[model samples]
Target: MLFDLARPLLFLLDAEVAHELVLPSARLAHRFGLSGLPGGPLPGRQVNAMGLAFPNPVGLAAGFDKNAAFLRLFAAFGFGFLEIGTVTPRPQPGNPKPRLFRIAAARALINRMGFNNCGIARFVENVRRARYDGILGINIGKNAATPIERAADDYVACMQAVYPLASYIAVNISSPNTKDLRELQRGTALEGLLDALGRERRSLARKHNRRVPIAVKIAPDLEDDAIPAIAERFLAHEVDAIIATNATVSRAGLAGLPHADEAGGLTGAPLRARATEVVRRLAAALQGAIPIIGVGGILSGADALERIDAGASLVQLYTGLVYRGPALVREAVAAIEPQAARMAA
Candidate 1:
């Protein structure tokens, strides 16, 4: 309700400006424990997946708190887990401004922000400085100018930099904005990238005496054949998990909505069915060979449970939280508990 009231004022500014401006205030709210001011039943629930124990399964996805900027805020809002970055090894300006668009009618967003971030070093510093006590995942990407052929090196470098601080690391090979980024999802290319990171995971584990999970985030804009192939490669390479279905480049789901023609990834309600389908396909292929973290189009408790029923062990949210606010999280978590009890029965 507060966010809805603020949206008229927020929407008046550039989308990106509203994003940066809102986060700091949220952080301040966290500092003062203002987040607890709203009266409600506490939503603290424990969930275990991917060999890590999450306080709850609802998490803020990669793009929201890029560079780990709003950990305190998201933690305060009761997210069980928080992911930050799509950070490259070195800093680079993403696509020009005006890259973020809100499709209010559809409760969707179309963005080509291009992974603009403060790079791994800055990200490490910020994350190290944050006071959040929940799970943190780091999403890493390659530089926009990096050739597709050399993408493995970039992923490895990012892993090396963030491994110490990250509870888990997400290899973001799905963002549509970077030139040829999705190409890494193809057969031989995908194997090579995962193999390189797999080797590093072992090396880091031996050095630190702790193994951090590595999850691959893939796009929903894939052929049926591609999903299984990627899953097989994941099993073969021993990749820890998969974030089944990132933002969709195919606008087939949101055809008549405003900005449906927007030239970037599509997320929100229109993304629900297709993203759910992707999670179902992945679950069939992997058969829980490894856990799948479902992303895309989750705006309600039923929506979150539908993804879990479709075979996701956990779920992440981005656009839905933007459209619905923190109440959505509580409702979704509340919804999950009853279903979880029934499943146990």
Candidate 2:
């Protein structure tokens, strides 16, 4: 109600500026205990995946709270978990201003903001100070300047810093905004990167005496034949899960629309089908060998459930939150209730 009314006003600001202003303000409200998670069919939606218990299957996707600074507030909004960051080892400014563009008619977004973030060190500090105590999944990525071949080094560095703090660490190798990052998703490259991450995860597990799960986040633009091979690598390397998609480079559904030709990954309603298809493919290939966190174009309860029906153990919201506000959270949980009930039964 309130958000819908405020949507037009917020929409007046540049997308990125509105994002900058809204999060901290919302965090302040949550900090003061003025915020509350809304209701639907979410009360009994607890789920256990990757060895962690999630209160619900709906989570706020990465890129929303990249530094984890608003965990307490975001956690209050009814997410089962939160994936923060695509943070690199060091801070970089990402791309220039006006990098984020909105396609209001299509309820979509195209961002080539690069991986703009406050860097791993500051990100860890933010996580340390956060009062929220839910399942926190930190997403790690390579710095824009890092060579594609040495991407493992950047990812390893971020994993080392965030391992203890994150409930799970998402290895993001598929953000189209970064140069050559998606190359890490190819056959031999994917296998080797997974190997390096697996080896490092083992050593870190010993040192920290806690084994944190690692999930690979992939792009949605993959060919139909490529998914099974990726699933094979995931199993061989023992990855804890696969975040079925990041965003897509294709604009299949947004023909002749504003910002349609924008360079960056396209997300929101336009991405729902493609991303769900990836989840479906991955599910068939993995045959339950590993879990999939379905994300991309989740703008409503039904959209969230579509991922579940297609075989996502969990679903996440990014662009949807931009379009629908917090109400989308509870609705997603409600939408997924039947699936959770069936599993429990």
Candidate 3:
């Protein structure tokens, strides 16, 4: 109701400006005990994955809270978990302004923000300040200036830094905004990168006396045949989970729409089929060997169930929150509870 009232006004501003305004404003509302401002909590069943118990299966994906500044604000919206960052070892301004575009007609978004973040140091400090004890997933990425060949070094550094703090660490090598980052997803590159991170995790586990799980995020723009092989690599490397997709570069159904030709990832309603297809394929390839975190195009309860039906152990909301507002989270949670119960039965 609140969001429906605010949508027209928010849509009146530039997409990025509206985004910058909302997070802080919402945080203020949360601080004032305006609990109903985000949305009242909905019932959710517990889901266990990656060795951690999720209060619910709906999560806020990374990129929303890149700096980890609004943890509690989003937590109040009732996500089972919140994944923050795509932060690098150092700060970056990201791509120039006007990078985030809204396709209102299609309920989708295109962004080439290029992982602009406050760097891991500030990110870690912010996370510490939030003191949020929910199931937190920290997503780490290499700096844009870093050479592609040495991306593993950046991932390792980020892994070590957030390992102790994260309920699970998400290794993001799939964002199309970064140059050559996707190359790391290929054969030898994937193996080499996983091998390095595997070594670091073993060490971090011993040092922290806790083995924090690592989930590798991949891009949706991959050959159908490529998924099985990628699944094989994940299984071989013992990756705790696979975030079936990041945003996509393909502009399949948006040929004549505004921002249809943007050079970054396309997410929201348009991404539903592709993202779910990837999850379906990963589920088939993984054959329950590893868990899959399905995201993209989940704008309603039915969309959430679609991902689950396709074998996503969990689903996440981003662009959906933009179009549907906070109510989407509760809707998704309510939609999936029966399925979760059936599975338990």
Error of 3 at 138 (Å): 0.3
Query: Candidate 3, overall lDDT?
Result: 0.90
- Backbone clashes for every candidate come to 0, 0, 0
Model 1, span 1-345: residue lDDT tens: 556677688877877798888778766765776654222222444667778997667777899988887776777665778888899999988998888988888888899999899988998898889865578899999998888999999999999998988889999999989999999998788888988999999999999999999899999999988888889988898888899778888777566777778788888888899889999999999977898999899999899989989998888888887777777777666666765433423
- Candidate 1, residue 335: the lDDT equals 66
lDDT of each: 0.83, 0.87, 0.90
Top candidate by lDDT: 3
- Every model's TM-score: 0.93, 0.95, 0.96
Query: What shift in Å separates residue 250 of candidate 1 from its native position after superposition?
Result: 1.3
Q: Write the per-residue lDDT of candidate 2 for residues 215-325, one digit (tens) a residue.
A: 999999888998998888888889999998998999887898887998899999989999999999999999998899999999999998899999999999999999999
After superposition of all CA atoms, the RMSD between model 1 and the true structure is: 3.0
TM match of model 3 to true structure:
0.96
Error of 1 at 80 (Å): 1.3
